[model samples]
Target: MYQDEIIQRVNNAAEIENSNEMLIIRKIEESEKPMELMLNENDRISDIKIRKLVDCIVGRKIIAEKVLLIRDHFVSLHDYLDLLNSGCLFDDEYDALFATFGNFEISCIL
Candidate 1:
């Protein structure tokens, strides 16, 4: 159900069966200079999510359309323990992350 050569396989299948699916794709030959932004501890989790969204979509011909686009940065025990002491509740953390993802999906659809 999953293949990396999706486009080519789909195109070939369309040719074999003469499918009427219109896959309108234009090759964008544009290149962009790499940009950088520095983030500090003061940045909110939502800001971090927006930065990740920029990495996913801006100036790219192909994109991975998945909800779980960004990975967790603070995976170690020390990270959570520090946040634990800093008073970031688990429910609030979950709410912020999911809310960001929901907004990101809506933005992409619109």
Candidate 2:
């Protein structure tokens, strides 16, 4: 019974880790979606996606510009992975450090 319980605990931990990994990947894809739309649409981005991007960048001033660079009124996806790893991706403090990257503002919407 003791060994069975130990095995179960280990399995549960592994499952949790795997779930977190998948969650991070999904969030990365979700946050990058706005920029992805822009790339395929000749630099034209969806307003909704831009809002999503903004939600992902708030309070992450350090990495904001690194993940996204805006110049001459054009926005480009920089280190996209940075956006994925930012704590801003998660709204809960318990899950904050479970992931990792930005500061950004919505100036010119294109």
lDDT of each: 0.41, 0.39
| Per-residue lDDT over 1-110 for candidate 2, one digit per residue giving the tens place of the 0 to 100 score | 36666667767877777654421112244543242222122454455665566464564554434234322222334322234344444445313322222112222121
- Stretches of model 1 off by over 4 angstroms after superposition: 1-4, 22-101, 104-110
lDDT of 1 by residue, 1-110 (tens): 24447778777888789766776655443452222222234434554544554444233332222213322343333332343354333454435433433333323323
Colliding pairs, model 2: 60-102, 63-102, 64-102, 64-103, 85-100, 85-101, 86-100, 86-101
Query: TM-score of model 2 relative to the true fold?
Result: 0.22
Task: Return the TM-score for each candidate structure.
Answer: 0.22, 0.22
Best by TM-score: 2
